[model samples]
Each structure stands twice: as C-alpha cells, then as structure tokens.
Target: MSTTERPRILVVGGGYVGLYAARRILKKMRYGEATVTVVDPRSYMTYQPFLPEAAAGSISPRHVVVPLRRVLPKAEVLTGRVTTINQDRKVATIAPLVGEAYELPFDYLVIAMGAVSRTFPIPGLAENGIGMKGVEEAIGLRNHVLEQLDKADSTTDEDVRRKALTFVFVGGGFAGAETIGEVEDMARDAAKYYNNVKREDMRFLLVDVADKILPEVGPKLGAYGKEHLEGRGVEVYLKTGMDSCVDGHVVLNNGLEVDSNTIVWTAGVKPNPALSRFGLPLGPRGHVDTGTTLQVQGTDYIWAAGDNAQVPDLVGRKNGNENAWCPPNAQHALRQAKILGDNVVSGMRGFPQKEYSHANKGAVAGLGLHKGVAMIVMGKMKIKLKGRLAWYMHRAYHGMAMPTFNRKIRVFADWTLAMFLKREVVSLGAMENPREEFYEAAKPAPAPAAPAGAGDKPKAKAS
Candidate 1:
C-alpha cells in the first residue's frame, strides 16, 4: 500500500510533547505500518525551559527552537493549526497560515496543542504587557530591556529616566522569577556602558500573589531565592497582586505605584483555548482529561499529554493522595510524550497499553549568572544545593536535556564564551520594526495631487 493509504497518526502540536511524541511514534511503529503527521502554527518546536537564557543572551534564540521538518524527516509536518476536531468523522479542520481552511482525516489523533498565558481583565495589561511563552517573545524581551537602558541614558528628564529604567515583572513562578533575574543581570551589565545610567538608577520589581516564590523548589529554597533577589536590589512583593498598569503606571493592590516602562506578564498559563472545539473531555482547568495510559477519557483512539492535558499523578495517588494531578512542566511533558507515543503505537497494533507512572524528579532553576537553587531527588534521598553549585547543576541538567546534539553543543559553547568575553549589552531595538526604515524610503510617493482636477469625471473624454 502507498504511504497515504497507511494508517494516519495526527499530532496537533509541535511543542515538547508533540515533538517528542511524534518522534517516539515514528520509532516504535513498523515500516509502512502507519504515517505520522504533526500540525502546529510554528514550523519549529521551542525548548521553552531555555527561554530565559535566550532572553538574557546566554543562548542564541535559534538554538532554543528545533525545526520540525528538519528533525522529523519521515513525518509529515504541516505549518497550520488544527482549528477543530470531530471524533465522529475522525477529521480535523486545518487553518494554514496563509491559505483557506481544509479538512484532514486521520485514524489516530494526538492532542498536544499546549498552553497559553493565563491573564485577567486588567486595565491596560493587554496594551503594555509582554509574555515569555515563545522564542519570539524572548528575543523581543532581550531587545526591549536593553533598549530601555538606551532610553534612560539619552533622556535628560527625570521622569522619563525613571520610567524607562523601571522594569516590573508580574508573577513569581519559574518564568517570572528566572526572567526578572536574568534580565536584571543583563541590565546591570548594560549600565556599565551607559555613562548616565547606572545600576543604582534602575528599579527591578517582582510581584506575586503567593507568599513565597519558586514554590516548585520547595518553600525553603523559595525563601532563599527570594532573599537572593532582594540582595540584588530586586523588590519582591508577596501576598499582593497588580491592580492596574495604565500608561506604564503600575498600581498594586497594596497602594504602591510606579511608572514602569516594561511590564512582563508571566503569571501562569491555562490549557490552549482551542481544545474546547476538539470534542474531548476536559478537566476543571481546561486540560484534556486523560487516564494513566495517556488516552483521553472515554476514547481509545485519542490521546493527550503535556501542559494541555490533565494526567493523573499515579505516584501521588499511591502515596495516599486521593486527589492529585501532574503539574504542567517540562519534566512530565518529556516523559509523558514518550509514554503517549508508546500507547498510540500499542493501540494501533493490538498490544496492551502501558500505564504512565513516575515520581517527581525534583527541580532546578537558574537565577542569573552563578546564582541558582536545585533539589535533587534520588528515591528516598533528597539533596538540595544552592548558589554557584546549583548554577552548575542547572546548566548541566538542562544542557543535557536540550533536544538534538546540535543545540546542546551550541548552548554549551555560548556559556563557555561568556565566561571569558564581556556580556553583550548592545540593543537592536529597530529589530522589532525592521521594515519601518524601508517603508519610509520605498513607499510609493503620495499620488501626485489632482491639482488640475486630474481625477475629476472626464465627461468630455467619455463622450
């Protein structure tokens, strides 16, 4: 039979789960047994755990993303989104980036669309906030923060300088804490080059509703992380929330106000909104409901795992926790995707599906240069490390976890060079609008005015 005639496996994302699942499925299935196809809006799969480093120039933005087509050569990669899925017909509606919507029929479906930033209806947040969900945002953030420094140095007005140098980050989770930490370090280095702007002139603030930050690393480490940031002159706001940020003026619930030019919203994320139309069972928080086998509830042919799916925490349940679910993170996503793929292949080939179960392997987080916190779990033994040692573990673990040997080498090389070379502080702000200069110079001159009624009705000529 031809390739098109083979059983079809449709993967609905190109993120960590989608990429690893598709790769695993391809390896497990026999030759010509099934054809794998992955669809996502982006052509590449971004290693989001490395996004902060990319934003801080510790790793090149390109290395943080893995091109789908290049890595999955045997699978069909579609640069489009699965707008809706109809299990009744086993078909999905595909909306390409620049084409009309089309229907794609498949025998198997993998729902791994991933998550989007969770935001509230706050005043001016939509207009002034930036997100760290994708690689583009990381690059944009790097440029934006450095550009703020340039603005602060050139301006003579006190208010402008204050606003430009004041960076406000909302949310104190991994993304929020790590990002503000990395960005603050970058700005500190950048200030050295600016004659007028010094590190003391800038203000860095982290706001979170939770009492402690880095809760994933446990409360003790969280407190340590908090103190570490505070030592670096970062104001850590606890048990508070952002009320408003109108016109770069931040108003906190505690009645504190600051005019900040940069507002990064990394509060949290919810499962992709697109999952609703997929006609699948969703949990309370909008994640696809799945069983231990990674198969969607009530469906054997459909599967989901990752930030988008609500998978049971089997280890937690066995340990006497009746209500436990896996948290959304790269650790589980990587492992879940592997098991999800195995289940898919098993379901297709008349084999028993494997149940997914794994204990939490702890967490590691890097906070700027040579500052970090880590918790290592080895069975019954739990080892905790902090400071420079934790920083090395952060790099070593993530450096090895990074997909593709090519990217791992590139990331390590970037770190090696940074050890001896001065930090990169130049701000390429125009990159955000690269076409502006070209448009001004090349846009068609305004049509010569109809000074002599050039566009008037030519009744005489017509007659």
Candidate 2:
C-alpha cells in the first residue's frame, strides 16, 4: 500500500510473469516514479519447468523456487490473493493467507494471476489424483512414490505389492511424460535397495488422449521419445483416456485396469478461476483478452499476460494465420513480462505503448536422465535432436532460464553434484503429516484439569 502521492502499481501475481514484470518495471523506472505492490498467495515464485526434475528428486524443491521478497526488495510483496478487481473504481480486494479481505487502489494493475491445473469431474480424481503444479506437489509426489516402493518391498500379499508398484500418469504432454520418465528412472535405481522390489516388478503407464507424446518437440522426436520410453519398459497408451480412478482403481478407456497407489494428473491448465470476478473482457477459454500490446481489450489501466491472458500471437499472425494466440509457456511469459512492464511504465509517463511480438524458438523436453527430445526451429531449417544430446540441450536451456543468478547456480550445482553422487531415493512421506506421530503419541487431556481445586489441600481454603 502506497500513498496517493505516488502512482501505485499493484501486481496481482508473483509467479513468472508477475515477478519478472515487476522487476522490469522497477528496473526501467526512476526513483519514486511509482510504488509497486505485488500480492500473491505464495511468498516465492515456482519455476514450473523444473517441477518434473524436482519431483524426480533430481533437484531440491527449495532451489526451484525463488523467494519473492529477496528478489524484489524494492517492491512491497503481499502474501495474499486478489479476490476481485473493481476496474471501474480502480480497486482490488485482496484476501491474505491469514486475515480479512481488504481493498487496495492502484493506477496500473498487472493481471498475472497465472493458471491452475485443469481437471475434470472424474470420480476419485479430487481425492487420489496428484498434480505437478508446484514445489509442494513435486516433493509430495517424490515422497509418495518412494513410500510406495517401501510398501511394495515390505508387503507379502501379492495384491498389495502389485498396487504399490503400479503407477499411472494421465496426459502425455511435457509434464506427464517428463514426470513418469524421471520417476520410472528413479524407481529403477531405488528398486536396487529393496530385496523384493525390482525394476521389472514396477509398472509405469502413461495415458494420453493425444495421438502422440511431446508433440511440441516435433513428430520424429516425439516418436523417438515414445519408442525410447517403451524400450525402457514403460507402457505408452496413446489416444487413450482414463475413464475412472475410483479408490486407486484405474480403468482406462481401452479396457485396461490396474490398481495404482500413485496417479499423477498433468493433462493441462486453465487460467485462474478468480479472473471472472475481476470484471475484465475474457476470451472463450476464460483468459483475459489482450491485444498484441498485452493491454486488456477495453482498459488502459489494466494489463494482462502469461497463461491467464489471451495475448495475440503477432509473429504467428504476421506469417499467415488470421487467428493466432500465444501459447502459455515460460518462453512467452518471460518475454511478455518485460514488454508488459515497459508498456506499463510508458502508459504512466504518457508515452506510446510498445507492442510485444516474439517468434517461437522451438521447444525442448527431457525424458529421464540422459534422455530427451529437442526441436530447434530457425525459420526454414528445423534441427532435431534426440537421446543424450537432447537431454543436455533441455538441461542447458532451462538451467540458464531458471531465473536469478542465485537460483541458476543452485540448480546447476544440484545437476553437477548429481553426476558424481548417487541419487537419494529416500521417502519422507511423513512430511505431509509431520504432526501425526506426535498427535498419536501425545498424552490425552489431563482429566479436565482435575476438577480445578478439588484435589488441592482443603485446609488451604481455611487460611
């Protein structure tokens, strides 16, 4: 919250776009030009591309997240969610993690609220389906997977062992494919420590509605990725969808059924549902409608970008397509943030806004350790790579793009050390309920405080 004297720039998110956009605005603006207040439910920004590696135990969860306060010392960081925005009054109501909701006025607003995991009303999904959206989920997935291995090793019953060893993954996009690949790799190594559990005993199945996996990396590479995973003994079910996963019982549309203790859902993501309350022009898919300039369709004071905003794909449109939109990814989010930041500053200073347009720079996907697919699209020439080389390309590209020199160093260090040291496949599943053990062992209530002074010295009352 800033005084009315200085123009206040209220950023509604602190994720990729919000953090970078605020940084850009602060960097471009002079001292006291404006007060930037960023409000987010989290105190840190999660670099999602590293989430798969984090889940696979290849990277530490904390290293993948950048502390918002440390990076934006100049900006007022609020640990809260913006409930609604009254653009008519230029005020946004915020609900902190632990407090009442309040309104904050702003001159320029940044709608970088980001997206949430897209899910359906599938039976038992809400209860059993895991997601890969954040560091917490990644950590939980790692622990749960390892814990399952433990159960499988210790259990004598064949049914119990089978359930513990079976893992089902929905969606064959980057997240789903990468997660299963890394997890299967980790499990293979982890199985060596168990007497009963072996890599051959564990079952890894990937279900996707799409005809191919890693489509963003091109067909040849995608096919290579599928074949490579299959070579590693992973069951790839393309053009297949999961029907129901009731109580850990997975039934696929293709008539395959299995009992899996771990089922990861990474089908897709949708913009924040709270966007509806913001009173902005939204696209058909519930994203903020923004032009190539990244400005809201009918508002000059409010700007939107990233997964939450439907920004026109200027490069794609320029080439040929009449209806083109920027896909939600880190590449565009980062670039869009910088340009959106400059435009916000320009708007404040009465200057013309600069349009944002960046061409697609291909895509990269790492399958497990030493396995991946990369497609480099340079105009007419499309260079493709697979296997170890592609894996290195994926690491190199994302390692440099992880945000902040501090985080980049930490991530690279994690990778460098992983090469020399064996991967730790320990399970800390108790982390989810750290207090459960204590609660169970804790003494019961002290007999309702012993009836107050009933057991005290009766003679003391006489005194």
Give TM-scores for every candidate, taking all chains together and pairing residue i with residue i: 0.96, 0.95
Alpha carbon lDDT of each predicted model: 0.93, 0.93
lDDT score of residue 304 within candidate 2: 95
What's the CA error at residue 134 for candidate 1, in Å?
Answer: 0.4
Model 1 spans with C-alpha error above 4 angstroms: 1-3, 444-463
Q: Model 1's lDDT to the true fold?
A: 0.93
- For all predictions, the C-alpha RMSD in Å is 4.0, 4.7
* Model 2 lDDT, full chain set: 0.93
Model 2, 155: alpha-carbon shift in Å?
0.9
Cα deviation at 338, candidate 2, in Å, is 0.6
The ten-residue window of minimal lDDT in model 1 covers 454-463
Candidate 2 lDDT over 1-463, as tens digits, reads 4456788999999999999999999999999999999999999999999999999899999999999999999999999988888877888898988878998888899999999999998898999999999999999999999999999888889999999999999999899999999999999999999999889998999999999998888788888889999999999999898889999999999999999889999999999999998888999999999988899998888899999999999888988998999999999999999999999999999999989999899899998999999998898788899889989999999998989999999999999999999999999999999999999889585555566678767575565
